[model samples]
Target chain A: MRGAVLHAPGDVRIEQLPDPAIVEPTDAIVRLSATCVCGSDLWPYRGINEVTEPTPIGHEYCGVVEEVGPGVSSVRPGQFVIGSFIASDNTCPHCRAGYQSACAHKVGMTGAQAELLRVPHADGTLVATPDDPDPELLPSLLTLSDVMGTGWFAAVAAGVRPGMTVAVVGDGAVGLLGVLSARRMGAERIIAMSRHEPRQKLATEFGATDVVPERGDDAVARIHDLTDGVGADAVLECVGTGEAMTQAIRSTRAGGGVGFVGVPHGVSIPGGRLFATMVRLHGGPAPVRRFLPDLIDATLRGEIDPGRVFDLDLPLDEVAEGYRAMDERRAIKAYLRP
Target chain B: MRGAVLHAPGDVRIEQLPDPAIVEPTDAIVRLSATCVCGSDLWPYRGINEVTEPTPIGHEYCGVVEEVGPGVSSVRPGQFVIGSFIASDNTCPHCRAGYQSACAHKVGMTGAQAELLRVPHADGTLVATPDDPDPELLPSLLTLSDVMGTGWFAAVAAGVRPGMTVAVVGDGAVGLLGVLSARRMGAERIIAMSRHEPRQKLATEFGATDVVPERGDDAVARIHDLTDGVGADAVLECVGTGEAMTQAIRSTRAGGGVGFVGVPHGVSIPGGRLFATMVRLHGGPAPVRRFLPDLIDATLRGEIDPGRVFDLDLPLDEVAEGYRAMDERRAIKAYLRP
Candidate 1:
């Protein structure tokens, strides 16, 4: 099977790799119908996060269960499914509390940017759809595996409520989906911070009531200006940079919450300022497993079209091109057909 | 009037000062029934926090309203009242949201260590009691002004729910009160981290089921051992030091919550570690004004005795001794009677 591998910074290759097979009784072998590049992949590709060795890339997928091990029961062969980035045994205390990403027996599923993948904790991690989703819904379903779930977590963490105004920082795929998630959660208004025209347009389509084409202090000021200096009731920090984190904190009202889903790099939360601002902070890895069922239903019902984030789609052989397109921001996101 | 003035580091003097007058129409003059030295006060006294000027200290008090300006209506002369350290105009958006400490028009109500103190935004800041309380309840009632309210906020912010295990980092007045607050909020087990025998005893009395006399990594390890390696469900960080903050985060289970109410001096939250821990974090100066009415009711009903934190008592002229005792940890807290 062909899989994408990062041999070095900016060096992504589509090369022959061993097809994944179930290694545990609870595991399942999935034939990926759709997979995609992630913003987080850029962390190592751009040489920001250290990549020690040639690493298997991608952690999101919409796939079909080709085979299930003896212990697999919730899902079986030929069923369409979406799973969390962090594979979790959902029966644990943390998983039961809707924090499956921190499940007691959790494992991060990687190498999904391939034709076949082995998923551990299949019964607890993978949620089967009522039927095979139509191809038109592939991108959206694929997002349920990570990006969309993360966006939903961001919204939930930010406490975006009905009749509340929310602000989203970052114009990446997660940020765009965050706007959709906020709207779905009944947020009255959403102000998306985006400097790119295409992302701003997508943000608007995703239900952003306003778009502030600014960064750092300027972005914060625009949010304040938009909200009568009170800032948004909930601010989603979808970018992991220090500037974005600080802006997100500043763009929230005194009692507002910040749901930061971005993989932080060099961010440092200044305790004094945070205390003075009195903004509530909650975030971390998205407990994607918890939101998978609802998000899947929403997608199946056509209530949201998160797949719009994937502007470029390519064959698995051109996975490097997909990574480059996303790296240059030419595509909001890239979808790879396996 | 006499007030405690900090002429320099380690020098707290009770000096004769001009009596306070209503500087604004919303101001009220209060004859303090009780004022106390706070753990935060020791910050400047120990020269940890810069005191550039001869600052009139003390920001916690419960007193009788002696005179009110024409604009004051919610509170009147001869009424017994309790207010927050931060005086807020309750009409502000933040105040309306129950985050009065972040009110747009807010002022720190200092100089309460003096015989009489002038309070601004009296209508919004002060919550009048039904009647004068018996002297036995004075200590607990005084705590409502800051420490008790802050502790309550910590428990609440930490999302302390029924049947949850809560760990409190810090053994000061606020930390002791946090154990009480967590118990009242239905936390099944409370762990107070303190090495001081007196503080540990008080912690037990205040509902701490376990007293972990460990600090830093030791504390984190002990908490893990207690919770079967899962850590506490909620952690209340009442100490402002970086070590305490780190320990609080480490002592909480993944996807747990950390409510930190310490007035941070030189603390910086390392985003990477926090992100990895996946702990929900919320904190700030307690919106005491929001909790005042309920707390006052509870105190009036003799439900809690947070005033047990005040282990030393001195006349208003001995305010210096009060500061000294707290600075030296000879007292958990000091009460100054004017």
Candidate 2:
């Protein structure tokens, strides 16, 4: 088996690695059909996040279950399935309440960028499609594991409703999908904040009614100006930066919500600002597992094309170039065929 | 007219002040039936919040409309009414969305400790009661102007639901009323966090099923123990300190909400903690105007007795004593008859 490993900042290499096996009674072996480089992956690849030692990379994945432990009941070999980046025992109080990312018995999935990946809590973490999805649906189905699910969670957390005016703070893959999620949730107007022309175009294609190229306070001003000074009814904060969070909070109308899914780097929200804005704040590492089943169904029905975010496609062996393309902003996202 | 004025920290004096007259067409002059010293009042008295000039103090009031400007419509002279501490034109987008405290033309009320108060946005801010109430209900009606309304907002913002377990941080008037509000919202178990004996007794009377006399991490641990290691479903943060906010957030389950109404002094929430906790945070100054009508009805019907928090009562000229008692923690709250 071969997998991508990060040796140091800006140093990724594809190396032959030992194949993964079912280690836990609840674990299952997945032969990944596809995987992708996540924006979060850039954090370590760009050296923004410390890379202390060589580590297995990539969490987003979708594939066929190649083997299952005797304890696994929900998913069987030969079934097409998608699981969240974080595996959960799904029956815990948090999981039952749709917050699987905080499940009592949760495990963060890693090493999915390889030919074979071991997924624990198989019965609880993996969701099988109604049947084998068409090959054309693979890209979209793959996103339900993380990005698309995160976007949907942002919209839901922000209380996006029919006839709402929603603003998305980032133009990353998740933010673009947030536009689609808000649209699906019946938001009447969506304002996408992005400085990149290509990403802005993709945002529009995903149902953004308006685009503001400004950042920070300027973006907040633009959103207010667009909404007749009422701000947006809901704002999806897809970027975890302090500036993005502030913009999202300020861009929302009082009583509106800011659903943030970005992994925060150095964000600290002043209580006074939150108090004065009177906006609802809710978000975190998205409980992607909670939305996988429905999102998979939605993708199979061709109701959405979230895979359009993958502007660069690569063979798994050339994973280094995929990381380079995304790190340099040359690709919105890089999809890899394993 | 006579009013309570803060000349400096720890110095509150009743002084002869010019009678307030309608300065705006929407203004209504009310002859105050009662005013009260708030938990927030102690901030300025204890030199926590700067009290620079000899400013007229007191914002909570309930009274009879003595005079109305020509533009006033909904309220007229001789009508008994209760308005929010913050006056607002309830027709704005924020107000229409039930966030009157964030109304476009909002005004923070002050000087209500005087015999007369000129309330702005009379038609939008004041909610007329069914009829003149008995003297016994005056204290409760006065609380609706701030404390009671704030408590109700906390419960509402926390998304309290039937059969849920709720926790309240802070043992002040607002927190006690928050316990009552959660009960009214159908919470099956109400945990009140307090160290004061009297406040603990009052909390139980207000429907607190459990009392945790711990603070900070200990309090968080106690709440989890109370809920079988599952944190409270909803938490009302009635104290604005950073510790209170942190405790409230840590004590709530993932996907649960923390509705904070305390006027924050020095609180900053780390984004990493919020992201990892996956708890929802929503609060601010209570949009009391939105709850006034319903609360007024409930008060008149004798369904709630929030005024029990006012253990000390004084005349208008003795406003200084009211401030002293509250500052020294001798009273949960102080009621003043103007």
**Model 2 Cα displacement at A78 (Å)?**
1.0
Per-residue lDDT tens digits for candidate 1, residues B172-270, read 999999999999999899999999999999999989999999888998999999998888999999998789899999999877899999988788998
Off by over 4 Å in 1: none
Q: lDDT per residue, candidate 2, B60-151, as tens digits?
A: 99899999999999999999989999999999988999999999999999888889999999999999887899999999999999999999
| Residue pairs with backbone atoms closer than 3 Å in model 2 (clashes) | none
lDDT of 1 by residue, A1-105 (tens): 999899899999988998887799999999999999999999999999888999888999878899999998899899998999999999987888788998889
DockQ of each: 0.79, 0.93
Grade the docking of candidate 2.
Answer: high
lDDT for each residue of candidate 2 in A108-128, tens digit (9 for 90 to 100): 998888898999999999998
